[model samples]
Target: MIKIVVDLLGADKPQTELVLGAIRAISENKDLYVYLMGRKAELEDFLANVTYDESQLEIVDCTQEITNYDDPVDAYHDKTDSSLIKGLKMCRMNEDIGGFVTCGATGVVLISSILILGKLNATRPALSVVLNGRNDKPFCIVDCGANIDCKADRFVDFARLGVAYMKTLGIENPTVATLSNGIEAGKGSDVIKEAHELLEKCGFNFTGNIEGKEVLDGNADVVVCDGFAGNVLLKSIEGTAKVVFDDIRRAAAGASDTQKAQLEAFIGRLEPKFDYNNEGGAILLGVKKPVVKGHGAATDKTVYNTVKIAYGLAKNNLVEKISEEFEKK
Candidate 1:
């Protein structure tokens, strides 16, 4: 069975909601086993009301919860028993455990992952997520929100991480591109220029620079950037998608019967494709194990998809492939 550790606390949503997501996952995949880590009473009370395979689930007792307000460094030492810390420990100690899932504060999760599981072959971990391009093909964005200040070499590292990730998804020899303001090779800052040169020589199907507007045009299989810029781009795209959909919904509400039916059908066809909840969370790559981080405001659907993605990562040997790629350096 593919075993996974899920930290049920520290999210903006209620613990019971995440628990329901996990149960949903277990119900669909019988070969999977989940170790749900959170308050024992709450877990037990919630599970008592649900119908699931008791043999496939385990409740880990955790007394403390890590909050966004806690100092990440201090919480590392103090909140050892918290769900976030304990879940990392479980991943580090057990070889059978495939991966971990959490909706904790990003800072604390980063710190604990480094301090506990450590880095693989001295490479820093990058947050990577696969987003669909205009042609409906998927492309990966590395360092979505992990490293705010990155060196030019870190861009190369993110590319390598993205390559490993895409390969795991069954895309062989994925093309890589550096995100820049303009498409020309010399259009970006010093970091982009240096990274672009390095990517060309470092190999792995390095394409030329890609502008922000071209990101979703299926121009490249992997787009690499620093966390600061990547985070802004990600949120902007998400906000824009939400606003556009809301406007469509509002228009549909006031439209004539025929127009409303057409608009509603149009939305029904496209809305799920852009829904963040269905995408689950971004995978933290370059670490010792796969760690998926979901949004703080995640709901039951988010957790269910996150668990499924985490399971795929573990089953596909994502961490081992990443380690092999870095070890070649």
Candidate 2:
């Protein structure tokens, strides 16, 4: 059985959203076990009689909740008993536990994961995110809001991090590209240009420079960028997806029934393809343990998917594979 710790107190919605989602995940996989971390009183009072296998579920008692406004560092010390911190400790202390999944403030989770689990020893931990790709598989972007300002060598480290991630998804020798203003080698800042040069020599099917427009269309298996650029790119993708989904829904609503049926079928397939929920959330790579962050507005479906992704990461032992790649003495 795979063990994953979930921060039930972290959802932007009622904590019930996260609680029920964890229950749904447990039902989906018999081998999966979750330690739901939150204040026990509210959870039990809300879901005391909910039917579930006793063996698969466990409620870890926690008192505090970390909010988006909390100064992550201060909260790290002051709110030591918060669900986010407690969940990280659960991941670190339990060898049976593989990783943690949280719908909390990303910054707080990032801070606590490092403080609790520590770094992977070779590389500074990075946030690796999976965005919509042209195919069934998603291309991963490393440093998606972790290190805003990064060095050229860190870009190289991000490349290795992205590579390990793609392999776990079963993409053998995933092609990589450095995000740049222009496809020409010299178009970006010195950092990107140098990173490009390094990527070429670092092995792993490194393609040349890739423009932002080409990234989601499957131009590369892994697009490496500093967190500053990656964060902007992630939101832009999210916004565009929202706009497109809205437009498509409006169009389908007015169409004739036959046409609407066809449109609905197309959208049903396309929605999951581009949906962040199905992708779960961005991964915190380069750390000793797996950490996944979902959008704060996550629903029960999104929460369920996040746990599933974490389960895949833990079962595959993704962190250890990453350890072998960069933890060179």
Top candidate, metric TM-score: 1
Where is the poorest 10-residue window by lDDT in model 1? Answer: 269-278
lDDT of 1 by residue, 2-90 (tens): 99999999999888988999999999999989999999898899889899999999999999999999999999899989999999999
Span of 10 residues, lowest total lDDT, candidate 2: 270-279
Candidate 1 CA-lDDT value: 0.86
> Global lDDT of each model?
0.86, 0.84
Give the residue spans of candidate 2 off by over 4 A.
Answer: 250-262, 327-329
State, as a TM-score between 0 and 1, how close model 2 is to the true structure. 0.93
Model 2: per-residue lDDT, tens digit, 80-140? Answer: 7888998898788888898899989988988888988988856888888887677655799
What TM-score would you give candidate 1 relative to the actual structure?
0.96
lDDT of residue 125 for candidate 1: 89
